[model samples]
Target: MEQTPLEIQLKTLPESPGVYQFFDREGKMLYVGKAKSLKKRVSSYFNKRLENGKTRVLVGKIDSIRHIVVRTESDALLLENNLIKEHQPRYNILLRDDKTYPWLCIKNERFPRIFPTRKRIEDGSEYFGPYTQMRTVRALLDLIRSVYPLRTCNYDLSEEKVAAGKYKKCLEYHLGNCLAPCEGLQDEASYHNQVDDIREIIKGNFGASLTYFRHRMKELAVEMAFEQAQAIKEKIEILENYQAKSTVVNPKIDQVDVFSIVSDPTHAYVNFMQVSHGLVVRSHTMEIKKKLEEADADLLPLAILELRERFNSDTRELYLPFPVSLPEDLKVVVPQKGDKRKLVEFSERNARFYRQDRFKQIRIIDPDRHVKRLMQQMKTDLRLSEEPRHIECFDNSNIQGSNPVAACVVFRDGKPAKKEYRHFNIKTVEGPDDFASMTEVVHRRYRRLLQEGESLPQLIVIDGGKGQLSAALKSLDELSLRGTIAIIGIAKRLEEIYFPGDPIPLYLDKKSETLRVIQQLRNEAHRFGITHHRNRRSKSAISSVLEGIDGIGEKTARDLLRKFKSVKRIRQASVDDLAEVVGPSRARKVYESLRE
Candidate 1:
């Protein structure tokens, strides 16, 4: 058989690191990917069966392939990221942060004036940030102004212009906020020195500024200028306070970027923390809209490059939640213990919180999208064939083998459907046989649903361990619905989830939304079962005590009990009092029965 052009291309491709682009029939880019071996990676699309539906579709749409060989895997990663952004292939994840972050720019001038800006120009001016929050920029600016008193006006403070006395200080000079640098009241050298200190502070290095202020304060105190010394003291306090608030870990840990990611089926949230001298100077959580079912390993690198570029972070050191491919020159630490690990965990917490907040907002604004995302998350977590939009949980309740009953609680769209809840009395299986009771209820519940032509639940939760799960499976097998509905059992002690024939249980994270929902279902079922069990026990006791008497029927017993709220009170009631409720003939019989 003759080989096709794609097969020939795949065979002839280099085994080196490279980026590959997939194009559709009409020459539109479908997807862009990076690989350590172009021959193996690109060939994988045709050779392997892609599990992700979107990836399978993307592969089906590919008409031609192109490759750009790189020297190293890291170079290939960077190129793939750049190509994805440049062309925005249909099957690539998109970094969704479009907000204009504020930066502290030091204007290019004789006496540089520093201010916050949203734009960066190609002039020789220095821009410190591209910070994640405007408030941080403002606070830094306010701190620098209070301590340094630099000029706010963007005047041409040239030497000749100042010598010619072409400018005058405004109310800023009167208020002592500026030293009148425009009028040469402050010298060029002194203003430049202040600018140097401000630059250090913006880089999250407060040592230079703090040392300068402390030295000045000492000089003023030595000269018996107590008021000026106190003023310097206040400036030192401000710098020290800000540094204290910003610093998070060991001050020796400097120039490192921390990245952590939390993701769902539709989106991924990546938190970036720019650490300088252990201070988290800039922290941001960005959401990425997934075009395919991208994993964390794929999404993290793209986000790392995009965020580092956007924030102008040149730090070669990174603290991440997991290992990833990057340039050999860059240090990547997947911290396992101690402060570095704590920092990574902190970033992870921020990403999770951001994801939850987005969920809350979406739930309020667009409930359908929120529900869809939640269902998708649950489906993935539980390894289900489809979304568990309608779920049922079963629990058996019996105290001392008396009133053995089962309660089935229904949840529609993650909320309890109270009207659909049903309770069952133990018919064939008696005593405290939880497993048998579970089998009977599950069999009966679905048997009726099948008989009535009602829809079955996507998931069934049995609130017990392997034994109960096995019992429930037997019922499903009898109904021939074993493969039709997904079922799992939850153990109460460890919150372990068990599947049929799978001995090893799955333990979800304590904070997982899926575990929370499962717990809610289990607890509701238990509560409902306990309530029904208690009611049955009360009714049985009443029947045994009152209905056991001869010639005292259920109606007379009910009438007597209604008049006296409790069985004990009914026993204490006089014959005349009982007659007022029931007739005198039945009243005497009831009175005699109570004494007995």
Candidate 2:
């Protein structure tokens, strides 16, 4: 056998941690991945049978392999992320955010004006944040303005210009909003001191600002300037109120970065929060679109690095939902309990909310995409070989064995297909035996669909536990559809999902979309079944009541019901009213039976 180019490259691959790339015969990049060991990781592609369909396809197209050996796994992770962003391989999860986030820039100038800007210049100025929202920037700037009077005008405020009195004090000076640095009213040292305090405030450290304000207030009070003291007191109150709103956890927990991820089959949402002195100084959620099946363990590390880099986070301590491989310079804390755990949970909530908002937006703007993603998620969660585009759920309803009935609610593309909904009277099963009733309904439902050449559902949900699921499976076996269609039973007690022949049930997360959809299916089936059962019981009661009378037939009973609406109303009516409905002969018999 001739050695292929891929085999040749694989032989030369190093056993060092690095990033790897797969390329096709046409010299186009197909996929990029990071691995702890380049040789073992790259070789596994050929050694193992890839479970993901996309991964299998990606491997089949690969004609050559390339790798760059790095010093460590963290370096490889960083390198992999950079390559993916730069090249955007076909089989890499791309970070989808395109909007430029706003940042608070402290200009590198004499007065050092602070303002919010989307564009970042590489000048010697300091930038506090790439905050997720413009409102946050505005709010922070307002707080800064209220505490310290700083120059907002863009001018050359040099010592020589101020000595020469080149710039005039405008409305800002008269309004007391600015100390008029351009006209030398405020010295450089005094302005810089205020700037330092503002810097601490922006970093979520309000101690210095509060101390400065308190000291100023006391000094003015001693000078008998009550108005000035009152003004300073109000500014101190404003700063304190803002800090209280921003603060979340224990004040001792400072300079920490928290990250949490929530992912679906197609996309992952990673939320980042920067904490300083227990206050959330910055927060943002990054959305990454997956090109192949990726786990949270792989996705979170990449996201942490990307987010920390984007936000310029230098916090040594990190609160994460789970452990991931990262550089030793960063401290990864997977908080099991306490305030740190709460912070992680808070970050997770943000990610979940972002995912939900994106889902709602996608549902509104791109309904097909939303459906496709939902189907894919269901397929993965249920371990199905194919997406469950059309789903059917079965539920048996009976109250003390009176009227046994079943309902089959159809959901096409994860939405109720009302027209395809079905109702089944328990013909083969006697009493309220749910298992037998389920078996009868399942068999009858699919048999009719097969007989009529109608489309069968991709998945079937039984609103019961192991017993009902087993009964349904027997019907599927009889119809030779056991392996053809996917079926699962949901136990109401714990929401446990049971599969045929599997003793153990799969438990889904409470907030998962898969669980939600399955619960929806089960609820819909129960509602439909209960409705049909109620109607049947009502009709049966009406029939038994009127037919027991010797003179009353089905038509006569129906006529009485149609005329008076109910047996109670019919009893309330006089003989004359009864005769008007069922004629004189039958009316007297009905009146006598009722009176007895």
Candidate 3:
């Protein structure tokens, strides 16, 4: 066989680490991939038999290939991630939630101000974290404020200005939130000491501040300054409390980045934890959607690079669930025992939890996707040949053999299709015979659909036990539709499901989506039936009361009820108002009867 243009291009590729692109006949980019060896990776597409069907299909559409050589695998990884983000090729892993997390900044100046920021600039300032939440940042800032009287104003507290006394103390100074550094009331050395303590605390090291306060308290106590010593004791307590709340691990495991990933057929969730002095100073979880069948190994390394850059992480040591290919300068440790192992497990748990939470949120926000998943689940659980996209549930409602009626609630794509619902008056059934009423309604519903040439439901659910199910089958038999439509009956007790010929009930898990959807349909049908039954009883009561009068008939009674809304309202109406509704003679009779 002659080599194609793609094969020739692949043969000419270099052995160095690089990024590769596949394009189709129409010059549309099909996929983007990174490899340690350009020639080896590009040739493998043609030499190796790809297991994933999606990859095989993608390969078949490849009309040409391109490559960009890089200095190292890490460089290739970064370039690939960037290209995937920019082009969003059909066969690259796509990250859906890639927003930058916020970091706490301490400016590099006299009387430096501290605040939370999302942007990382190249100015001479120190950044603490790209925290997962703003709430965490705020809580840390509050703790710092309580412990130290730091200035909150954005002022240029230069040495010259302070010497000249160019500025005055503001509200923060009077409120005790600041030490009035602008007015030269605060000592430069003391303010710088406080700033150093704050830097240590933010780095997850509280020992320095605690030691300083303890020494200060000892000195104050020795000098017989009891009041100042007491104040220093309180400050120590606040710092210790804040430290206790923040620490989650042993202090020995310091200055490391932790990563763990959880993936499915179509997506991967990666969770990152930045540990400093055994405390989780920063944590985040990101979700990536796979356009191709990419594994966790392929996705995690790229994600680590992106997240590290985004968070401005500088830790050289990393704790991961598994070893990944990274730059030689970085140390990767796959912990198997002790606190490090536990930290890895914790990161994995976070990733799993985040994946589950993201799925739940998606179901809530995207109803169509939720319904599609439910329908597919129902199809598998029930062993149906096709998805039950259109389902109709029948329920009978009656009050002690009076006002018997039935309701059929239609669900299209796992949601209540209200307009497709119907109410039946139990025309052929006597008394409150539920089984007979179900049969009559089923027959009437499908018979009319067949006559009108309308589409039929994929599944029929009768809200009763085997007897009611058999009755509904009888209607389908009459219509020559038995075994053509999927039918089941749900017993109210224990929520058992009955089929046509099976004597044993099929009991689904109580928390299964199929069972929940069935229950929703049954409840909706019952509610709909009860409403119609109530209306029928009220109408019958009004008709009987009005027809008892001498001059009134059935139609006249209906007209009177329709015009006045109810019998009480009709009775409340004046004789002239009643005359306009039911005419002169009947109005007089009605008015007199009510009055008497």
Candidate 4:
């Protein structure tokens, strides 16, 4: 039920624990929230004293409200997190904090094996934390090296080597950090004792360690060994100084690794925050390729595995945009509220800093100038609805009907999904017919959706005139997916955009965000389609006989075909650099083969 009187909506709210919703006059779902008491929380907006940016905006347009009472606050928390994710409410803290990072793992089993890992093992091992802070982890490692003297070695030791004295200790051994178990300087029993002490240190039992050290210092001083006392005092100072330097606060808490991924179509920025108990001791950000598909949950796992494989680190809690299965021995924590929430929020904010740090514009070399202008002009005109959300665009490219191809690209919140970039090889259409090509691509795209029974797109843009749009609509109707998606055609008119679905072309006013986004999409489709087109053409262009000739191979041959298109031009190469068209390897072989 929807109503306009904000007071009436407020009166309907209950003081019970539940979730709430706010809607605009058009009944567009704007925000979804949860509270310990639904009535109190929902009515608080109408209370007139909750002067915050989000609250004020919500209050102003709150035509109606809905309530769902949960049994408890934890239920409310879970429901709210889910609802907010589903609705993507405007007011809630929308964080894309997914992407696991590496953490140090010590298996909680009978033989606790400590090593670097991002995966959480479920074998009943105590998980320490996600150490997100790089500096903190480094300092802690340095301290562990000096005080705990844990083994950093990872080499296999043969019994013969131990007996023959053929193996020597590494630099970590010379520095008196690692136990040098391979050198046989420390037996398993003694090494185990040191490892147990190291575990205590990671557990932050510095008070006990400090007490033991102080007692030893006193005992040495009483024995009149001045040098020994001085050395002990120095070691104690190192331990104390390390504790003071690391962590953002005192009274260190258990270890946790926090991870946040800041990303769009073009890039991904990952921020790691390692906390020892409640103190933040390490933090760093690594920029990753924005070219990955964020929509595929499986892809995220692969990306994370790749990242951890590249730059492995020990961590505890792994705060992410998505929940990942972890090891039983590790303690992964993220606060939904209170102190840990603040840290997670802060980490998320840091992840977003890359928006300004770098803006890489990957442009298309193809003649996407007009299609680009159409996108530019569209954003120049946002007359009614929220510009366009979940836009699906399509483009068709072919080579004289032999290899017809079409690509459909998706854009969300004004960014492209290069990872979701798909290609269609015009199976149903014959020869250079863009309309039929469009029909084939559209049918296949929606047919899958039909088989799956999913929600349709909000808008569809085609890289052609009215005919292309009609083809798309026919496909939608055929698949019973019409009315679910709106269609618009962006046709090029002699280097100008003709949005027949709209009134004008190249409606370039100024600072057009829609235009920029549209241009980005069209260019992306063209680039992707043409790239796929070129690759197809090249693969069919020549034989390995040319490859065996040495003067030409893959990259160079493609370049030669693209540039000169004939062996005559390639054979008449002016310089080795010119022959270097494919690649250096091909160029070298080509030059040598030519000399022969």
Stretches of candidate 1 exceeding 4 Å from the true structure: 1-247, 326-331, 336-338, 555-582
**Ten-residue stretch with the least lDDT total in model 1:** 243-252
Model 4 TM? 0.29
Model 2, 469: alpha-carbon shift in Å? 0.8
In the range 309-329, model 3's lDDT, one tens digit per residue, is 998999999999898999898
lDDT of 2 by residue, 1-596 (tens): 65555665665566777678888889788888889978798889889878999888888999976565445575465455546655677777553234344668889998899999977676777766545468988998998897788899999988888899899999999988999988888999999998998877876678988887799899999999999999999988888777422323443576899999988889999888877643454556899999888998999999999999887888899999889999999888999986689778877865765576567667655789999999998998999999999999999999999889999999999999999899999997777798999999999999999999999888999999999999999999999999999999999999999998899999999988899999999999999999999999998998889999996889999888988899999888888999998889889999999989
* Candidate 2 off by > 4 Å: 1-247, 327-339, 562-564, 572-584
| Residue 474 alpha-carbon offset, candidate 4, angstroms | 1.7
What are the candidates' C-alpha RMSDs? 16.7, 16.4, 16.7, 26.2
Off by over 4 Å in 3: 1-356, 360-368, 581-583
Between prediction 2 and prediction 4, the one with superior TM-score is 2
Model 4 regions lying over 4 Å from their true place: 1-387, 494-511, 542-596
- Give the alpha carbon lDDT tens digit for every residue of 196-246 in model 1: 888778766799888888999999999999999999999898888875222
Q: Once model 1 is optimally superposed onto the true structure by TM-score, how far is the C-alpha of residue 530 displaced, in angstroms?
A: 0.5
To one decimal, what is the Cα RMSD in angstroms of model 4 from the true structure? 26.2
Candidates 2 and 3: which is better by lDDT?
2
TM-score of candidate 3 against the unseen true structure: 0.45
- After best superposition, candidate 3 residue 568: deviation in angstroms? 2.0
TM-score of every prediction relative to native: 0.57, 0.56, 0.45, 0.29
Candidate 4 structure quality by residue, lDDT tens digits, 1-596: 44334554455445666567777888776787768987677766666587577667767777766554444564455445545544566666653234333345565532244655546665655444345444555666566666666665445555566668877888987776666767787776765666676666765656766787899999999999889888778878876765322222222234566666665443466666555534443445666653445542434445445544554646544555566555565454545764466556666765554333233112222124334433433443633233355778899988677678888898865667667678888787657888888888999998886679865566777887667877787788887766556666666653234433555655543334455565677778888899888877766755343566744556655666676566555656655656445656666565566566
Clashes of each: 0, 0, 0, 60
